[model samples]
Target: MTHTENTRVAVNGYGVIGKRVAAAVAAQDDMTLAGVADVATDWRVAVARAKGYPLFGATLEHVRAMTEAGLDPAGSLDDLLGAADVVVDCTPKKVAAGNVERYRERGIKFIVQGGEKHAVTGHSFTAENNYDTALGRQSTRVVSCNTTSTVRTLSALKQAGLLKKARGVLIRRATDPWESHLGGIMNTLVPEADIPSHQGPDAQTVDPELDVVTMAVKAPETLSHLHYWTVQLTREASKDEVLGALRASSRIAFIRMADGLVALNSVKELMADLGRPHDNLYEVAVWEDMLTVQGDEAFYAYMVDNQAIVIPETIDAIRALTEIEADGATSIEKTNEALGITGRLVPEPVAA
Candidate 1:
């Protein structure tokens, strides 16, 4: 195939985020899937190859193994970078620091997932909050999924002139859905005794202007990470006003019990029914039925799918770094349209 002027994007790891990012790049009209690399024998290497991504091995040995598996990778990690404009490093947390150093040494453009510290790239990205700041960044860090939701909800409300401060509780899943080898706690666990969990400060990494404090507890469910938000608004708001704002926002998707998919399980069912890639709901699922307002104080409940919500942000980061789209809304809309992320994924609430 003849290459055009599209920005070439290589995915450095074929784990959850890497696979998703690679697919997203393939879907983008302005981007091309240069290649993807992963460690040896990950099964997903074949998945990448089946998806038509030029497979590269994370190590030389991985290359040989994948070649035996008939994926016939292009080369090793170095070769992947040599052929690409940008690398999206989606390796595990323990592997990220070393990868970050390599990207820096090679003078290659890269975007790291939220697992790493904000300093990993020195440009924490959440398109709704700081798209312009990340434009042309040599190293970009897409904030973690939890922080992504907090920042997105806050950014839209702040822009609507209806928010003051927010305090949230992150009901985190005990483990990633694909992590079946690791057993999760049967009882609820509070990993952080601190009044505000690290996510509050992490959200600040993306939106320092938005005042947010967060706490966390772990639930047994691996389906989704649920969050409860209590926000103080600058002025009184009605439920309709809040819903109107969210319905108008670019990245927010609302689902309610009236839609006949009240709980998280049924939500996943809906995504599966829609034939979503990997059954992923890429948007932060806000519960419209839970939006409550009382005398300038409002409460909201939402869920973030760990495997999915961050995909769009990573795509936006690529465009921002490549200077293809300077405006957040434009980049976000382009990415959303390319990925088929239109209006709310849930059906409209049945007449109550």
Candidate 2:
């Protein structure tokens, strides 16, 4: 569909992430906020309608009214499937999976949140690292926010041939029980002792040959999740080179190369300073002195807040996966180059 007509987009969930997605879509010049589908009769729906966003099928009449107003409303979730070219599945994990299959069968494009419960048929995408891969790809899944942040930096390092092996520890805070019925809260500071933690596997899905390990700790706070990364480099790459490369990435906005220890609170403040009116895709608060250079091993620590780090990436992914045109091709090329997987490579060094 042409950009003018492509304005019609549907959002399947209306929670925090869904609401943000809806706002982002509505703000776009080429896209229109078609409707929203949620079981609950939350105030957000009214907020959407007040902003002239058409509310489609929901469990309640207020949403039904939106359908009557030329917005398609499917009282049954299945009815919502055929209504739009793109469906953003912000529903809970279990619900998201079923909807994904249904959309695939009906030949609809979809955007699934990282925490969704279902398996989707798209490449794992981050705008900075994987937008080129997402372009024209029918199905794409945005990786978890933490995964996006960590992988973006590491991917750049990999491109420079500085990264050899990687390990990380993630301390996450659970949201309210209603956030995700599955466990997100209730657990704090517990070490996930398994080698190659779940985050590592997620990263590998994007780059199969990457060697990485991860551990998890659940915190009580609900604002953002944090990560501590230790990487072993193949060569003697300086902290300045690493930070400079990271800053060069358009996908990364706020990066602080810490001379000493940098706390999570400080990172949050840096995020505030970046002054991104919308949630950012990712930011790097580098702990440079925390960088340990032991022989060939290089360890670095950093922090990323999940929501801010993933949202903008999702926006860029949708633009790439769909036929929506941006202002220039240069942005696309730069994003691909940052990911290290532009599908063009230089020959490895040969010994004399």
Candidate 3:
């Protein structure tokens, strides 16, 4: 459990987030992937095994099954946590409560994702928005991708004293392309009679004073979630000033028509072209052409790469919960460098 030079970290899920976290941990100079565990001995376990991560069963019963499946699980989930400096529970929403208790019982620092409520971790973490508040927390929940986008945008405006209040409609994707069964594939789906959905409240979990409202719906597409936001600014500012303020943060990337970026698919294509691990686009893709202002009303639309945005935040949450790196900026910079994160659309800049 000692974290001086290289902190040991374990991931307790082999699905989307867990696998990504494990890979991210291995990519870090200051952290090593201890092991990754899961209950199901499915293809994901096979993928984890193929990646050469020490595989473990989420429970003892799964150990025998996992071994029989040629996964060669090293031990149980508890064993992985016991031997690691920190563990991140990438388990599903309701599945995390028991794991959180196990983390507490083992006195192991841990990280959770946004799917769970705030009670699971007692602190909401958005690396761009609330890294300072996450310092020294025993457990941190890296806010959901949608919430991450919301807070990052508003927090930037708040820092520049431009945000008065904001409201937005989240045109969410049906699901990841792989999860074709989980959402309405051919139709737009709305929450059962809920206004503002859960995103506004979820963002509030990170910053209690944030004055934002949200309405959400799911479209048939699956690549990314698009957000149409309107910010009521306290001061009159030009479109350039607003974009400049948002572009000030490395976590947000600008894609304007001038850059030949016309749609969200182009951003995804760019992430793939960069050969990003998991094709992850850590930066929130802001549309420069979409940014407009009239008097105090500012409007813009951005696309959230749902699958990849939270990956770096999970890394930052690890640093915060474990105090492995006390300075949030340093940790974020290190993570970004390790993952080759950049606000620049091109990996290498062309000559002037």
Each model's TM-score?
0.95, 0.78, 0.95
Ordered from best to worst TM-score, the candidate numbers read 3, 1, 2
Model 3: per-residue Cα lDDT over 196-238, one tens digit each: 7899999999889889999988788888899999999998999
Top of the candidates by TM-score: 3
- Residue clash pairs of candidate 3: none
Tell me the tens digit of each residue's lDDT in model 1 across 1-352. 1234889898988887888888889999989899988885766777777777898888898889888887888999999898888899999985877887788888889998888998767789988778888887898889898998888888888888988999998999888888855877776675667878989999888777878899898888788899999999999889888778776677788888887767888889999998899898888889888789998998989888889899999999988888877788999999889887887795557897
Q: Which sections of candidate 1 miss by over 4 Å?
A: 1-4, 347-352
Q: CA RMSD for every model? A: 2.6, 8.2, 1.7
Candidate 2 local lDDT, 1-352, one digit each (tens): 8756664577888777777677766656556666777765456666666667555554556456655564444454455655676777878765777677777788878888777522565478766566676777667787887788678878877877778988888877676324656656554356667766688888877787789888887786665676777788887766666666555655544333442225665555544554533323245545545555665566666666665566556666667767675522444453334332232111237899
lDDT measured at residue 290 in model 1 versus the true structure, 0 to 100: 74
Better of 2 and 3 by TM-score: 3
* Clash pairs, model 2 backbone: 7-31, 7-32, 57-73, 93-117, 122-139, 174-184, 281-309
Q: How many times do residue backbones clash in model 1?
A: 0
Model 2, C-alpha of 326: deviation from truth (Å): 8.9
Error of 2 at 310 (Å): 1.6
Provide the clash count, candidate 3.
0
Candidate 2, after superposition: displacement of residue 312 in Å? 1.6
